[model samples]
Target: MNPAQSTQPTQSTQEKQYFDLHTTGIGYLNRIREVSPKKGNPFLACNIAALSGAADDVVYTRFDCRVSGKEAEALVRQYEDAVKQDQKVLISFKIGDLWADTFTYTKGDKTGQTGVSLKARLLFISWIKVNGQLVYKAEKAERPQLEQDPSGQASQGGQDDQAEATSSEDSPAPAAEASSSPKEAPRQSAQIALPETVQLSKDAPDFQERKAALKQQGYRFDGQAKVWRLPTDAAKSAIEAQHQANAQDWARSAQATA
Candidate 1:
């Protein structure tokens, strides 16, 4: 080897981490929206109020998510139904972006606190329990190979396509023909499964904490159902106002990134 080759530094390699998110919590649905910030690609966003700490000394954590996939859609639908029917349910969610920020409340008192947020771009909700009973269960969302590659080297310029073409040459039929075949064609929605309910353990620790925190927030515990209740009250209006504000903020962020 040349002397210069030995002396030269090896460039640092950065690889994307896969399957890094696994979060499970119980929180109140702050806000939910089915929006297409970009054309054709739609996503669901939810601003959730997660509970923290003991009942006597509770901290209100902000758990928010912006995600695409069928599970997200189902979550949005469930949130809507809960809102419409005036139901309070406990949930268990996982695989999302978890973060914290210290910011002013902006609504009233102009308070500042270290609040956490969870963005579930790719995630699974293990279960949802209502009234200490299992209502729904869901599995983790299946990851798409080309959608998010850990190497960050695929799909940008068709690198993966080139390799796939070579390896799948003997896959019984050409990819183009296979895609073009009417019966074998795939729908855009097939990328993920439809949203489903969660089946959480009634004894989950977080469920109790979530119930207590929600109760502190004026949510009543229904003696009939034995579940914490969420009211279609002032908070919904307040959250919608925040939604509009977020749209404005999103526009600014998009502009900055662009």
Candidate 2:
């Protein structure tokens, strides 16, 4: 018996073991299945109408960033330049209503008075895109026209209700008892309701804070990563110190050579 030949496993033997295991595994079967289509990165587009009635365009963008791989790549690339320089850049576009208010009231003995109470206003917001893509697109926003004049429900409630409410308000008696009693302290109003306060998470509570804190310490944020860089003064000092050290070493080297 040739001991060497007996001990050495044939090359075909190892390959067969691998082939058997591969065919039996579930993962191997999955690999044989059709390859899934690659889902492309998400993006946002804005449609704005020109107020003067001009042509418009669509904004396309993908985010590429460092926080997350492949996913943030497009987004980070989109805003990377601005973030590096600590500059403000367009983030997103918003469309909404501009409201106008007209007031009707009586002054002194004047029977009726009407005038513009509030001028119409427009609000623009810029922020991170919540969904797949983040983009800022601006186009003229048309102000809504009053097709049918808005009716003032409170104003049209009639003088009867107003007189009754006013009399009850001024009289020193409960609304129910006011009609019955001529003299009594007007029942106090239950209470007036006020809007609740809204609290917002700090601007990029994470990223923005890092940049702001560095700036407070006299460091400038720069580079695509928005690294905290030393200011000009500190940079100059560091350079000078390095140069001095180098000069001293050079002097010693030159003396030794001499």
Candidate 3:
């Protein structure tokens, strides 16, 4: 071996990287059918009228989705009869690998006009509500715990603990730790006690407006829990303030009527 060449570091092989874009929301299921393409396998496809904006002035964005996951496909197929019957089938869905496909209209009011269709693969069916009734909900898969040895003790316990401690030290400080103070600890703990998601009553004043605003700010509605969820404390504060304001307004209105 050449002296200088042997001392040099070996070049590492490049690994493949993937960029994924996923959209999750509630929508009305429509146009359910099995598409048998000339090439490749037959697949289930459907159109989703995704709901957005304020309830009073709601907006719908149509997505031409291919059912990708086996469970999602099964769930969608089960609702085909209901959809065909013209009954409303609402679902909380997750779509991935979205793209816009442009095509010329063959027949319609806009014949010979070019149109863009939003296309994506329906990867998950979070929950299904048919005609305002909860019918199907995807079960949350429990995470597998680390297995232990025959002795009921964690394998390589000491070494793993030391490694975890070292990793934590190298990582950026957590929010609680970064803002640590004698007076702030209790406040931090109280904040931590708040749930990851919150549900508001349909009868709440300006509920539609609040929902639209929160959705725009990246808060997702959890269909299963019937709640709006965001990981940030700021969102929780906003929701609390909205509730308080609603209460005060209701009280003032009652007094005036008396």
Candidate 4:
């Protein structure tokens, strides 16, 4: 409600909203690499492709990412085993870092392949269907690991699955991918897939002015929670710009008085 806070200067800042993200798609465990970034806690990097359409006309969006948390590490092991066993699965990703990346495949001068990278930090192989039977389903809060491996068509499968999946002993993990230096067209930095974050914040210095600007931009405020709520990210850039300007003005005022 402060009059001086009504008008503010323009600002330019770009903060991505895709931090905590969730996406569902078929995953590709194309390549796995062994890396020791700081040593001891070595990690396996994975390259994946998320398909959106039917197999005949599927679109491939690539992502190169790493996983390290206890639950995450276990789930990845199951993922690799599933790949070798040729199981049909769906994945849920909790993205930590993400950015634009390019993958170019050059097949002798003329054939070029390019795609978008969707990297992730924590990936949960939530559902698995083998031979049309739901053999594995990770609980909502559970990581994808079996107490025992599933049986083949003939024998009963049971912990042997975990034992077989213990590739981490032979190969630990983190991520980004592992590729030998190829003279051919190489992949760019990989990107992770994350959920989009909401822009509304309650801690801005010019809270009242921001509230007014958000009202103009169609963001609604809930008195109970004392937070501005937005239906979508359609006008987020503009609102963030205003937030930056307000912060700058406050900084300048503090300096002038000092």
Best by TM-score: 3
Where model 4 places Cα greater than 4 Å from the true spot, the runs are 1-19, 38-41, 54-56, 79-94, 102-118, 130-133, 141-258
Residue 48 in candidate 1 has what lDDT? 50
Off by over 4 Å in 2: 1-226
lDDT of 2 by residue, 1-258 (tens): 866567777787885431110000000000011112233233322211111111121111111111222322343356544433433232222222111122333664223442221111112222322112335322223211213326643321232233223221111112221133222212221111111211112443233433443343345545555445555664344344444443554465456556
Give TM per candidate: 0.38, 0.15, 0.51, 0.38
Error of 4 at 80 (Å): 2.6
Question: By how many angstroms RMSD does model 1 differ from the true structure?
Answer: 23.4
lDDT of each: 0.43, 0.28, 0.59, 0.44
Query: How do the candidates rank by TM-score, highest first?
Result: 3, 1, 4, 2
Model 3 poorest ten-residue lDDT run = 184-193
Query: Over all chains combined, what TM-score does candidate 4 have?
Result: 0.38
- Please give, for residues 1-258, the per-residue lDDT of candidate 1 as tens digits: 876566555566555565544454454444566665432345567655444444433334455576544774676576566643444444554435343211235463324321212334435554555433457655323322335468665531243234223321112111121223333222111111111212223564234533443443445556676654446663353344445444554465456556
The per-residue C-alpha lDDT of model 1 at residue 172 equals 17
Question: What stretches of model 1 exceed 4 Å from their correct place?
Answer: 1-19, 36-40, 55-58, 100-122, 139-258
lDDT of 4 by residue, 79-111 (tens): 676655544333433444343332343664223
Q: How many backbone clashes does candidate 3 have?
A: 0
